[model samples]
Target: MDRSQVEIEEQGLGANPYGLLLKALTLIPSWHYFLAFLILSLVFLYNFLEFHFLQDLFSGFRGHPVCFTYNPCSVIYDAVVSKCRVLRGRYCATPWLSSPHLQTVFLNFNGRPPVFSYRRQLFYTSDGGTIALDWLMKCDVSGGALHMNSSISRNETTPIMVVVPGLTSDSSSAYLKHLAFNTAKHGWNVVISNHRGLGGVSITSDCFYNAGWTEDVRVVINHLHKEYPKAPLFAVGTSIGANILVKYLGEDGENVPIAGAVAICSPWDLL
Candidate 1:
């Protein structure tokens, strides 16, 4: 072989291009490899910290006690019972009565258009706090003058159903509207309890409500009970409202005034 041929053989270009590329990769700066290793190490540390320590800590404190006497297990038990399973002694009932009606009302204006009419009427609590409510009234032709917005009537014998909505919801919510419509079709009076700060009611106070806030509900129920002393009262609540209703019932113990209650999708743990 000549000198040029010997030089080309020494370079080994025709042997394997991938081998040459691998040799070049070894020559890469140490800083690049260090940075890659550092990124991998940080990712592993983050995952380890999150899964092993942070997750356990959060789980341990998931439902921290709100009151000294508050028993979370009781709340959980009530929630499970609210599901309406294990009828009598054994065997679950199909198509539970607590199931919410599947109907969606985007916006209901009663008789007026959305731009001109207000669906809910505001009322003041005993503590001077204000709350918005939607009423389903019954009519009578007797001498009694019925308030158009009140959820009571003079001659109607059907029981009243009060519905309390969850977070970020109001009387016009789909579930609330559906419940009202269904109960009304069943010849019953219905009312939707819109929490303070929601349902377009100007919140007069700076206080925000939580899962176990039942004072507002109690006040509303008291008003209804006084107004319709003979009629039965039933309450149904969803999500956070369900928790509040359950808590109220538990707190009341044997003195609960309402005939029956149904709670759906309640979160017993509020921490």
Candidate 2:
């Protein structure tokens, strides 16, 4: 048996839970399909979402008729908006996907989209849950000459935006992917901070992450800060993820290292 299996057995993890999870995820086919239509709908589903959604894949829809920054006369209400150039298009580019209701429900169920580009990996938090992370790096660390190994999460210099999804959600959600894609375009490194176990991350401990469990977020934020000290770090969260981000910010107060943060649809009642 491998060392990992031995460790699992020693910890009484019951037949190596992570091994089983890894095996299952390996068989998880492409996200471009509906249930029971996997093999048969490959060609159809591919072209359907691929061709249709790929048009504004990076430039996704805008939220709220309140502020449509893509429109010339639209107001920018958010304080921490980016300096990136606005691509010429409607504020709500794809009304089909961008509608707040559609986006919210789709995000609630972890919907995937076309051109889902990211480097999916795992971040073992101090509290023990293996948080599934999707890294979309724009840093210029090529040739492996930066002395980076497979273990290193990122190299320095390029700014980063860490996105956290809410309960019952993961990085696969359309809304989260949209943000990640747009951030990647403007040369900002994007990393989706999926909650433990929601995004195919292997469960190692008996405990799973909870909304008020800000320790995991604290560790994640500190880790990111340490990994890319030279890079400006910012955070974005939706729903419960947003709640956690807010708590963390409040906990740290003026000492928070984050350059800025934006939390959309934060669940205040839960806290």
**Best model per TM-score:** 2
Q: What is candidate 2's lDDT per residue for 1-271, written digit by digit as tens? A: 9999889777775567888788877787757435547666765754644433444454453322333335334344232233333522334445466334555566657655535446676778655678777886543223212221333335566778988888877887776766776676677788888887788776887777777778777788888898778888899988888888998899889888798898888875863
Prediction 2 global C-alpha lDDT: 0.69
- Model 1 lDDT at residue 133: 74
Each prediction's whole-model lDDT (CA)? 0.68, 0.69
Q: Provide the lDDT at 247 for model 2.
A: 88
Model 2 residue 130 CA deviation (Å) reads: 0.9
Which residue ranges in model 2 land beyond 4 Å of their true spot?
1-112, 139-155
TM-score of each: 0.54, 0.56
Best by lDDT: 2
Worst 10 contiguous positions by lDDT, candidate 2: 140-149
